[model samples]
Target: MATHASAEKRNRQRIKRTARNRAAKSELRTTLKKARNSVKTSAQDASTATVTAQSQLDRAASRGVIPKERASRLKARLAKSLHKATAKLAAAS
Candidate 1:
């Protein structure tokens, strides 16, 4: 229990921030998963999903929910995988 009023206020802020961050992280995971799955399924649809995921990542990073470098890394990897997958499909045709 917080003995001081300031401490109690800080605790409340922490609780709210935690909840918001958790929701952002959860949504981020879901977006990433959808991007990965789309990459495995179809290149056309995968591009759209990847873009959406990248946008979400940037938003999260900007909000401080995730690090900027980490978000950039993830976006790069997603783009790389998408390119490789599309290339493989192109070669197959």
Candidate 2:
């Protein structure tokens, strides 16, 4: 479909970038899900998962896969959930 040589080059670049971005986004989602699941399991696991998910989110934001504020908001929510889970565990014990 690309007529010009420059257009063909750009098309190739777009395809590669799409794959890379998709992989990064998928990784981010997986990390986030793990963090959320860990919250329901245990505080220690939740803490580790939160850190990993936060790091992945930051990387995704820096790479332009997600917006900075969006990443920050998600991180905040994760932290809040982690805190609540930990507090509930502490109160129980």
Candidate 3:
């Protein structure tokens, strides 16, 4: 659908960028899911998962696969959940 030479180049760039972005986002999703699941398993696991989630979120934002604000929100939620899980575990003993 690109008529001009520049437009054709842009279209190719877009295709390549799309593939790269999709892979980045998919990796972020997988990491986040693992983090959340770990929270339900144990306090140590939750702490590890939260740290991993924050790292992935920062990477996603840095790479432009996700917005900074969105990444911050996810990091906050993960931290909150981790705190709650840790507290619950502590209270149990």
TM for every model, in the order presented, reads 0.98, 0.97, 0.95
Question: What's the candidate order when arranged by decreasing TM-score?
Answer: 1, 2, 3
- Per-residue lDDT of 55 in model 2: 93
How much does each candidate deviate from the true structure in C-alpha RMSD?
Answer: 0.6, 0.6, 0.8
Residues 28-82 of candidate 3 have per-residue lDDT tens digits of: 8998999999998877877777898899899889988999999999999999998
- Cα error of candidate 1 at position 81, Å: 0.3
Measured with C-alpha atoms, the lDDT of residue 60 in candidate 1 is 100
The model with the greatest lDDT is: 1
Q: Lowest lDDT 10-mer window, candidate 2?
A: 40-49
Model 3 clashes, total count? 0
Per-residue lDDT over 54-91 for candidate 1, one digit per residue giving the tens place of the 0 to 100 score: 99999999999999999999999999999999999999
Q: What is the lDDT of residue 34 in candidate 2?
A: 92
Provide the global lDDT of candidate 2 against the true structure: 0.95
